[model samples]
Target: MARSTTDSSSSGSSSSSSSSSSSSSSSSSGSSSSSGCHFHYVIGDKIDKYVITKYLCSGTFGMVLEVIDEQGIPYAVKVIRLIFRS
Candidate 1:
């Protein structure tokens, strides 16, 4: 897969530099764990080659995010949280 670098500053937030890979893998800007697992992804977060643009919505199971590819093509991705029993 191809990799690309993006300017996080475009999202209007100041953060450390990060790179993105061209793959279908899932990622997040950050995450937090409480009763279950919650993933927090912000705008400009590069997951694969797509940059998160807007947060569509979230449910008890997961969330839908609006992202755009390097070519400016928009797409929606669903992030699901898995619960593990020990």
Candidate 2:
């Protein structure tokens, strides 16, 4: 039997029905033609913690940083600049 290549939807415990694409990614893009897609989204908004410590680098893109959370755990956040146009 041949493996099917269709996106299957799933739901989280929160009753949220977001997408978890099976092959939209170049990681496995075959069926559909991608004009060009960029995946970027708000990060810390989901956490409600952490503080950005210092600006690490910014280029044609936006910014990066060294951050510390409420638990004193350090992390790096890369906030992209312009919205990607496909």
Candidate 3:
């Protein structure tokens, strides 16, 4: 699996709490997909308290991501794509 990182702005003290809260909510809802077809995750993206640290390799079924928890423990997460047939 390949690894990479994207650029993101540093959060300010005032916006930190709000952004964290929003990130938590959105992560739980799993509504990251903007096109409704696939999820494009970038470095620094938060998913259910886990922050994406790398862009791992992808396969036909889905893609793998390297994420870290609040404690700084790393983990690999596979995000499966859903295909609907007519």
Judging by TM-score against the true structure, name the best candidate. 3
Models ranked on lDDT: 1, 3, 2
lDDT of 1 by residue, 1-86 (tens): 12322222132212211222232334444355531336666568777778887655456876555667788755555566766779
lDDT (0 to 1) per candidate: 0.52, 0.33, 0.51
TM-score on alpha carbons, each prediction: 0.54, 0.38, 0.55
Report the C-alpha lDDT of model 3 over 1-86, residue by residue, as the tens digit. Answer: 23323322122232333333332323222333532426765578786667876654446766555566677656556676778899
Clash pairs, candidate 1, are none
Q: Write the per-residue lDDT of candidate 2 for residues 1-86, one digit (tens) a residue.
A: 11111121111121111121232222211111221213232323333455434333334554433445576545544444436468
Q: Cα RMSDs of all predictions? A: 12.3, 16.2, 11.1
- Candidate with best lDDT: 1
Model 2 stretches with alpha carbons more than 4 Å out = 1-47, 84-86
Candidate 2 Cα deviation (angstroms), residue 25 = 36
Q: List the residue pairs that clash in candidate 3.
A: none
